[model samples]
Target: MKPSFRLLSTVAAAALVCCASSSVLAQSKFVLKLAHADSADLGTSRKAVMADTFAKEVKAKSGGRIDVQIFGAGALGGEREVVEGVKNGFIQAGLASGVMANFFPGAMVTDIPYLFPSDEVADKVMDGPFGQKLSADFNAATGMHNLCFGEVGFRHFSSGKKPIHSPKDLVGMKIRVQETPLYVTEMKALGAQPTPIAFPETYTALQTGVVDGQENPIPTLIFAKFYEVQKNVTLDGHNYGIDWFVLSDKFYKSLPPDLLKVVTDAGKVACAEERKVNRTFTANGNKTMADKGVTVYTPTAAELAEFRAAAQPPVIEFLKTKIDPKLIDSIQTAVKDADAKK
Candidate 1:
């Protein structure tokens, strides 16, 4: 028997309604787990604030439908493990530093020493087009959504034995670095023997004299108690370390459109707050370290020039061979444009 046209149309409409209803119901049941290797107290740490803010906003925007569970201080695992877990979908998200670069070699470009002149310059470059493109590229390659970049601040040299004012001073020194090729190459180019070590184990390495010194932001030195074992802190500000907020693409794609928007918006807000907190913490850490009897050394213009002149060429040449030369040029141009605006 042939069905009437009206009857067939009616049946199709009902099926469409059923599918729409099912999708809405599924969207309402989403949840995400975010983790990081920092303590929950945000007193002076921006990363902590970012993690907390993201969780709160996601819940509020999704009307508590999309629950975001945050684990701090390596509760889930270390940075590298957390990133891997995200990729495999065991964990939904994580905030990781350069160590995560080992999985994405393009990220290594940002870690080049003396590349950024100041915090202001770093902020301008990373928040601009270049950073946005890199974030997208990382997402495409790793199947992880790159939300926004958080700050780890500029890394400086701190040693127990000597004050580092120029490249010559670092000669033959065994300096601790993250397990990134760029860091190892940078340190080697500057005449220091690079020693790769995990962040959580750095203080012990310094204390036990397993390594002569290490480089990290002032706030990190204070937070991790590196100042206790290292007497001299040099404000060389050699490299800019950025923290990446990476989320599982599989999990994100499963979310409803509305919930996905909420997650992205929340990440943007959290990134801004985290930047402010990091900057303030860095400023205050200097004074805190001084009060704790750690000597702070600032290099003279001539001394800084010498270090820059020595490190830049080798890094530039090495990058050309490893990465697209045009990409390196674009990064340099972006940085120059950013500096000119200031």
Candidate 2:
């Protein structure tokens, strides 16, 4: 059975009392409630691994002074709601994907279609100085502290009908997209009629022919069982999906200096582990999807270049109006710097 928050609070209070009674009054154990939208059964989902790793590492590093409680499968709420919970201090931390960018538009820069050339490029940019600055900017704007950046990999198109080999294939097709302007505009630019739908409702949308296809990372495509409904999977790799580790400023500041360090350091460790697992899963996930009767397609280099060029202008134009031009320039410079090191 899941442990109740009341019970955990009571236990924490009792631990504090015990410490108070001791002559030395050692640091008492503190409990942090972490929430994410994915189910525990998805082995490749970074959120599950992150929760497990963060809890284990923080406990080990803090010498049992910090306890982390994980609530997965939207048991807490959706990404937007979870972000709100963290902001209000109702929850200590959240594991959210690009949806969180809705609250911090500066993050929208990462969602620019075709900006990342490859997975290696994405890693270099996100794990380097640019990523750190974006995290800091997000925290400052939202009043929440961002601990680390983790990847969900690049998203690709999956459909129940014909294979998507080029931008023209997407023409007149109704593609499901997250309710984000970046996604909608990109899809429209590529010739598909973008349909914004909540994630939980996507399967039915596909089943009822409400949408012709949807795009997602391989792990998410597999975990969501999209392979069951979709006959074709295309590795268009239009956008790099990113996940952020966000902590409540209130909760973070409440911790002792050493404990705070433990949380931050543990985040970095968890990010490394999660990135390794995600990379390996992405490599094999296509084969796994194909085995399940989904026809997988990888565009040739020239074809991919054409796709990238076609999808770039609309997103760039859209961003020019929505986000600061200087912030956009800074992001471009950061990507260039990351590439230079490689």
Best by lDDT: 2
Q: Can you give the lDDT of residue 297 in candidate 2?
A: 88
Tens digits of per-residue lDDT for model 2 on 1-342? Answer: 356988998999999988778834344568899999876654766778878899899989988878799999899998888999999999999989867767888888888887787777788888777888888888889999889888888899999989999999999999999887888889989999999998889999998899999999888887788888999999978988788899998899889888999999999888778888888788788888868988998899888987888888889889988778787888788777767777
Name the runs in model 1 displaced over 4 angstroms: 1-23, 197-201, 208-210
Q: Model 1: what TM-score? A: 0.88
lDDT of the candidates, in the order given: 0.85, 0.86
The residue-by-residue lDDT of candidate 1 on 123-227, one tens digit each, is 888889998988888887778888988888888999998888888989999999977667787899899999999887988999999999999888888889888
Provide TM-scores for the models. 0.88, 0.88
Worst 10 residues of 2 by lDDT: 20-29
